[model samples]
Target: MELSILIVDDDKLLVDKLEETVQWEKIGISMVFTAYNIRQAQKLLEEFPIQFLLCDIDMPQGSGLELLEWIRDNQMEVECVFLSSYANFAYAQKALRLSAREYLLKPISNQDLEAVLSRIIEETREKRERRSAEEQNLGQQRKGKTEFWEDFFRNPSEQERMLAQVLEEGFYQETDVLILEVIKIFADDKDINYKKDLSLFNFVIRNITTEFFENNEQVMEAVAQVSDYEWVLVFRNLGEEERFLEASGDLKKHLNKILPQRSCMYIGETRPLKETAVGWKQIEIMEKKILPGTDGILCERDISEQDQMLSGNAAYRLPPWEIWQKTLHNSEDLDGVCRNICDFLKETFAKGVLTIENLERFLRELEQLVYCYLGEQQMSFSQLFDSREFDRRERDSFHSLDAAVGFVEWIFGTIKGRGNSRRSQEDVVSQVKDYIEGHLNEELSRGILAKMVYLSEDYVSKLFKNTTGMSLPGYIANRRMEKAKDYLEHSSLPVSRIAMEVGYSNFSYFSKTFRDFTGMTPNEYRNHMTKNSSDKK
Candidate 1:
């Protein structure tokens, strides 16, 4: 993190100019030391912990190559850049042989110096991170819960010592870093349940990956559980890039079998041992990019390509979420709801700027809205459909705009099936009327009718009034009186017994109520009905 650079040139004025004009400190090189001769350069090298060496090839006393030889002999951790007035082949050959980072012919332009310094700084910084990663493997404690991750990213200088030592061990020389995000959906389950499952699942996947690499002698790996849902695996490719990919794909298959469609894996780009941080950064970026309707082994190349980005509704805007909610909330035809969702998803994919973050956020909020809407219908999503299954679809199911839209449609389709078990007030009001007429001998109240149709008492009253243009009690009483007249004319039963059958306990009250309903006494109406019947015969 705190790197120092040494500029050794026989030209004093050139050394001073190079030191003053170029800001070495900006590139993680905290200290810049200059020397006029090889003796002075060697003394500075011995005295300081310099990681980068910028030395003149043609120094007085001894050549820059000789000074480099001493550095190699001492096994010092220094990257070198050779400077000379001429592009001599012999000097260039010697510099290459000594593993110099860059060879700049003198009267070097500012652009050349800046380019060389920028490269060296990046190389040096990566060297530190690789060392830190190796130290993580050396029982020096890998970052717990990404605590060290934040610190390492925030300030590299704070972790220089162990990182430098880690690189010295030369652990991972050339490797590919794979970040596997185990995606799962648990319906009607708590966060505690998810946490428990994730822990067990992460362990199994880690074990599987380790065993996979161990079985192949061509590969070696270091696995870290960087977050609750993510695992970071750095493996030496050993010239088997395809093999690594195959193993990742196979691992995805295995995980899918165990966790169903809830599990997914993401793999980053393969990189050299020196650029470990680049692969890490790539993983961080690519993890946010899951292909729609995909569950496993999403490669960086798969999402980075424009073809993938343009695959789904990349041109149109979605109607507001509230519109979808209202449609699903009230629509009876399940097929219609699904079709509308499909059309909207197309538009959403095409019109909106889609990124993994915004897209996933949109899907999550939509799921919540669906849940709330279902609740208004008095339907429990957990009871009607597996929340666990849908939960996976909610999170792991998004990979493209088309896929996202399909997932939403599928969810609505399931809701329609459950909705079939429940009906509206308008549809069931006739059934309530039929029941009231058939049960005139018994007490028929709005509460009873509501229970028959699974609606509230107040709602049943309103529905009956709205449909029949009469109050529920008025309908019931009128039906009872009409039934009483039919019985009086058709049977020889006494008025009191007839009253009992028609749900009237008192004979006098029944007589009075019947008179009020039909504008005549029951006996009078019966006599009239008999006279009409005889005349028709």
Candidate 2:
């Protein structure tokens, strides 16, 4: 559990005091290093394998906060605790952003300092245990072909050279190696929630691969996380050029079938292993063109050397990602937005601007986005896209532009026709009712609800009664009562608090209303459920 500690502070006196006072050896801390600036600390890092860093927020040359930020940006693993004399909340907030373990005030306390160091020591021990476990896994990898592969990539010892020579003499001459580069975006930025996104990517890719190239085996593959936003998958498959091209259509179609939502992909052309770097560069170029929030399966043929040139330094390169994200965030009618995008694609194709590969890639990106939308809406894409039955509302949104433009015109004309009665009072009434039920704790008067839905109070009130056969207040109370009954039975919240939660300010009135509704007060309801449960037991 011994740890190497680095202290980065400008104060020589404090550094000497800390080094002398702290019982380093007894606590399993062997080495203590000091630096006044980030550059010096970095040099020290190279010289000594430091485990934890105690950094001062303010320094003469550079602050400790700056050093921590640099470390985080570079994906450095050393744990850091911030020490600052200035009582600045902003600095502390920034430190927290960098995931600093602890923030300490100036003139550090002996007890506080010791406690923090002890915690870091334990953490370092845990990290060592985890690394030890991984080392065992890596050791297993050193057996079989993986060892040879690792040696080929990591180092060039005599054994690695001998293996290469053997391969060159045997299967290397007969085998036609083609590299399949699968680039994944957003590999970093996952934070604690990366598993969800990673699982989705894995699930979609598995389905696509199975549906398309079922038996076609890939060889000598390499998959790496390129960045937080991307993944690069190099599939070295055992196949000739013709076989690869022949499977392309099925591959594209299967991707369409499997990933029917928004996700973009740029597939590079299959090339011989000698041209691996050339093929990989094509995928890399596509990455620069990939717009945020876009999902499509694209081929290398879809991109031109000219497109790359034009895409250079343009303010309006149309970040596929930004537009794709906006398409979901800005539009209430997601289907309409998607259809608009499709129509845009169709029009762009007519202009001969898009290659078949680019179009397919764009479609894949669209499919992933749509999948995300479906997930958010608690709907299944299969259920929505199934051929047997279709949702009329969503289907209607996909009409030709002529049809959509005409309808929009018709709606606009109709708005002009009865002094803009297109804003349906019924729509306002339904929206208000749903909104009130959602925000039950708020003071929801007819005036507030009307203003929210952009309608007159009188109009909203009349429409409310017309639709539900009750006044707005009565509807709210009934809904609140229903929710209260469920919470009362299941939750341990006090009856009085439950009353307030359900929008009843007066606990006595809530009890009376509860009794009136169910012939039992909130407390009585809870007791009845409890007694019934005991009887069942």
Candidate 3:
């Protein structure tokens, strides 16, 4: 997800060698992606944050130059260095036209590559700084009282400390604070898009609320934007509870005339300046308990009912996701574990014992835990989740308490689906592995291996890569070399015989492969093992 570099080449062997020899981490790059062709490289570019591309000029299916063209066409911000085997002036001219970092001839030295990369990294850093400066300039333009209020709630006491300076030029009663939670407001069918017309939405919420309460003789009111979706209004010198609440009821009627949601008046309890922030937090936390269509003015006193419900019973409370994670890890009791979780969720959401906020919070935490566990296996969550679109109904909010029950059950089913796919992948890889071990003395070409597993060569290759992060050829080579090492160390067989045993007819070629794999020739490895055995004796 962080900054990375991608290396694309049609020659898998060349790709392997380049990856093995490159000191990517030493050159301040921790992530380097490799692809055999342009399509795979394009997918990586879309999903991951790639800063640079070290791509060969020619590849199968699509060339690196074509990939560069696609990147430029998209106006994507990625620096590319072209690697070509030829010294064609036409290619050079095209590379220059595409604004490539450099057109490097094949067989460039590592030092030269490193030097080129260092320059690119410097340029990348400068590009990032320039972008950050531009964003900061825009942020400064947007910064004002709204930004101040957002910061104030995060560190309430500290911001309250700045009250004096803020009020030096302007005056207000900072004693009583009202935190208002704004949900969606649909104005009219054609002009009611909040996402597209966010400024208009913001204007209606703030400007209207300010005008409604500004000149009330009982209160000196000041409202400021707390977040994009919420605002805080501070009222001063307002005394009686009944009269204030009556005024609030009238205020709600006015708000309803212009807004969509009746719960827009979701207000916090009045508090002194020292305790006002506590009031703000209380209102937000209490909002989690408010059911849709069952609302009036919500006060701190309304929270006690939900608190009593949760504290009164274990099944009524939020599920502990960490415990579920442990259960999923050693999932002998998966059905029972999931069943219990779902039953409790049914009781919580279906019975209206938990608030929407808590339900969402719990579900989000559950998703995060699943993501963390899968990420450790080098699995992609978006790849797993986004590819499978949920039914449109599943995307909507729980309209009824019974619907909320169904929502929680659906979440467990989704997780189980992920687990099932993981199991299926393991089974496929396991069968292929069995074939590999049984046919170690025979040719294990991708074609041969794919037939053994009843899959096409390309399918087998992709499956192996997805499961083990190893190309079919790379994995087969690793297996062969591992067998060779074991034979050299533990058996009295000649190097030639051992090479043949590992399915290599040419002993010299086998020796070269062994050296490439382990940095030692077969005979040298045998000698080293004999010397070590003697020393041990």
Model 2 lDDT per residue over 310-334, tens place = 2543222132655756666666454
Report model 1's TM-score to 2 decimal places.
Answer: 0.41
Top TM-score prediction, candidate number: 1
Can you give the TM-score per candidate against the true fold?
Answer: 0.41, 0.34, 0.32
The lDDT for every candidate, in the order shown, is 0.67, 0.61, 0.67
Candidate 1 off by > 4 Å: 1-165, 172-199, 216-218, 289-293, 305-316, 320-332, 343-354, 364-393, 396-407, 423-537
Q: Candidate 2 vs candidate 3: which has greater TM-score?
A: 2
**What is candidate 3's lDDT per residue for 1-537, written digit by digit as tens?**
256789999989888887889888777787889999888999999998888999998666987879999999988889999989989898888888999989999998888998899888888888888999997975564455456556676676686565555556453345534433333332222334656555755776667655665444443244556555555655555666567666666766676676543224555555665555566666655544443322334545444544643243323365777787777677635566667766776566446555655555665665676577667656555434432122222333323344445555655565555455554667878878888877777888876665454444566677789999998778777888999999999999998999888889988899899999889989899999999999999
Question: Rank by TM-score, descending?
Answer: 1, 2, 3
Candidate 2 wrong stretches, greater than 4 Å: 1-176, 183-194, 202-214, 217-220, 240-261, 290-295, 302-346, 349-430, 434-478, 482-523, 526-537
**Alpha-carbon RMSD to native, per candidate:** 30.4, 23.6, 23.5
Cα lDDT for residue 241, candidate 1: 68
Q: What is the lDDT of residue 349 in candidate 2?
A: 41
